[model samples]
Target: MSRREKDQLHLARINFLNLIGQSNPSDAWKLFCLVTPNITEEQVDDQAETSSKLTLTTIPPDVVEMIVRTIDIESEKNVRLTAKYLKQIVDARDTMINRVHIHLCSQTVGIEVHEVTKEEPETYSFNVSVIPGVNHIDNAVKKFEEIISKPNTKINHLKIDWVRSEENRASYDELLKSLAVSLADFVEKVHVEELTIDVNAVEHLENLICSLKPDILKRLYVIGPPTCGNDKFDFSNIVILPQWKHLSAFTSSCCELICPIHHLYHISNLRIKMASTSPIDIVGYRDTLIVSQQRIDHEITISHDMENTKQMLEPYIDCSRLTTCRGYYIRSNEKRLTFELKHNKIIFSTMQFLM
Candidate 1:
């Protein structure tokens, strides 16, 4: 074959291989040799480089993401790390890399792990140790404060897992108090879109939520049971800031869900799972009330019977000021009701009232 003809064949093979590699790397490797007949290893490498450059230039960014996502993270981490074009594809999309997970093993050993599946073998893990003879609570609080102060990092989600620690239970309360203070302070400055806290320490959870200013927290999820103390737990003291839009609670105690809805009027989305079957009262603006209630294994029943439960909701519904509801039934034979109101009319009425 002529030199020009051979070059054209090589380019074709290169483009074909690249397409397959992006779509299915394992399959691409299996068929690599058949398409590039008599091509040496060095020639194949050069062709791949040429094809990568061409792909980067010609393909739309979103299309490149589809190709990058096809590769398994654990198996192809090295390949992704080495290829500039592939790395760009992974970074452009908000895949797994943007999140950080912190697991508290014990007072002595704590593990912070960050995994991004889009990047090849680019896993980052940091281990934080408590100062010897010093308080682990202090160390955790310090680290948390540092994370909150950094403005450039987009840490919208935080997960705290407290691994069972027999040795650390003695000082758990002090540690929890410190952690709660830090969390409460953090929420004030940072836009915490989602928070997941798993600790045996219930006091910390209460303190953290109570201390939080609530203007910056858009969503909250507390995982654990409520604490029993000398004083009765007053759900009213727990303030639900106007900024809170989504609230979720997983507690062994059924009563914890009642306070947030009864006092906090701004939540638009709410999910709560409790140990027992108890009647729930939901109150909110007609435009922003979306509630779902379910039992452990039994059916979930959602009521649009806002008027039946609370008289205040009647005026909001009658005037057409508040109007949107969506409920989902999970597991049990339950009824769900949803409503949507016209906001334009509500706005006009409010303006007229002001005049």
Candidate 2:
């Protein structure tokens, strides 16, 4: 190494330490990179002379933590590559990723990462697309796990959308199954507060939802494929899982729930669409909520046309004298259940009362 280059490198290291503490994290890192351009681990460890290069190991761990915490993910990655000690420190620190969105459409997979801030949030988008006949689902998931699996990382919101179309419906269907299996294996490593997913298959949905950390997941939204006629999406396996039972609120895409209404009573708030509404099921669910002490609100929309309102309500109450778009309240004990019939929708909510 030349004497002049060594002196310049040493001066840059001294300036980096001085500026890092005085300037904001983003500015400090930018300046540090400008001064130490393309400095490899080998250069960092060079023992050419006594006063030449400065190794990051000489810096105290507390100072390293402070520097890392202020920088962005990209800077953190660069810092980790500098030395083994830096990598360990960076790996152990908790990084708060405010939100993540994963989208799978045909053959392309998109990943968006959002960082939390008081004002507008910062977003990073990554789209990974493979060739026509290769399996890209596995590769996409691996990239996703690399971010979420970081030690002590907490994600506030996570959303996954599987956009399936008719162009390659069969191929997408097979890919969806593969994606589900991969997600089921690694989803346990993620800690997210709220999740919104678009899944069409019951088995795939079950595997993904049931694998989440129940204690961390509070709200879950499921968007299933459109249904017609008597066909319904079966949630038989999901209602039994702890993740479903512990949710504070749940929203489902407009489709018939194959499971009975009572299976959803435990959730505090609910918005669901039923393929076909039966007076028996509506009355039974109403009766169950009225007698229970738990407080909840539910809005159920009947997707199919309801031509006869009288026939629908006859199982629970007399609706022969009632007109369309009427709001009715049924009170039993301390609970009051409001039932509104508007077109094909039934909006009913239970009131919370102090015991």
Candidate 3:
């Protein structure tokens, strides 16, 4: 083995010694033999020297877990190949690792689904291009199916950026149906706290929303050009679950006009970007109720050409119970505007009361 590999093995043995609560020579030798291969007297002497040369420190498992969790899987794979002992450490702690991200360059499934634990929390994002030779849709579907069969696996968040070439664009509906069926099952298994989907294939936003299992969805963000010709996008067809509390949309002016904000009574954060001018009533029934409960927080971003700050601020001012309002606003160029409202009270002293 190389010098680096030898050093790693020595570190692993020291770590293993610390884990089993035996740091003395007698216990270390016994535990080392139990876990590692038998070694000669001369080899043991060399390993002891190597271990002594390095600073031996004991770290709590929770701290180690946090450190390991921060290392991306792809980077960990490189470290594992350095030595067998390191591989063991990674395998032992794989389940506690929470975040996993993969950037796809090839059309094939880059990762083996079986290698990862099902219950381990993971977030996945795919950046893929569908060229004549690259068939990402097929590969993606296969991976999706494999993940669904595992009972406890939950992908808390998923983002897909799909690009289709001019020559080899496939049927959008067929692809959507296949993906929907595969993901809808998994979506039902876990509470989908966040989801971001960007696709040029689907013409209507409602069609995309309809394809998902609606009951478990809490946050939905959609990004694409407007499909509906008018300012009002129709969301009447969608069944908004009571648990759904956040909605963000990036679309053309006409699409924002049709966005269904009235339907989302539970939503606390609503962000929308529109291309054209549209009248918005900020003090709607939902806002009034949320304000009463002290749960009001919202942001609305409109195109630069359509500026209506006074009109937009009218509803909030009218609904506010307090005479003074305190808030901050920052413009696109980093310019800031701040305001504060104050209240005054008067007190009478004993002498004043007597007079």
Top candidate (lDDT): 2
Best by TM-score: 2
Worst 10 residues of 3 by lDDT: 345-354
lDDT of 2 by residue, 158-241 (tens): 887766677645644555576566657773546778988776566766766666787888888888777734433766667888
Count of steric clashes across candidates, in order: 7, 1, 6
Ranking by lDDT: 2, 1, 3
Report the poorest 10 consecutive residues by lDDT, candidate 1.
343-352
lDDT of 3 by residue, 121-235 (tens): 4433333555676555556666566654454333445454334443323433345556666555554543344556554433334454554444545566665544545433434
Clashes of 1: 7
Rank ordering of all candidates by TM-score, starting from the highest: 2, 3, 1
Q: How accurate is candidate 3 locally (lDDT)?
A: 0.41
TM-score: model 3 vs. ground truth: 0.44
Superposition error at 43 for model 2 (Å): 41
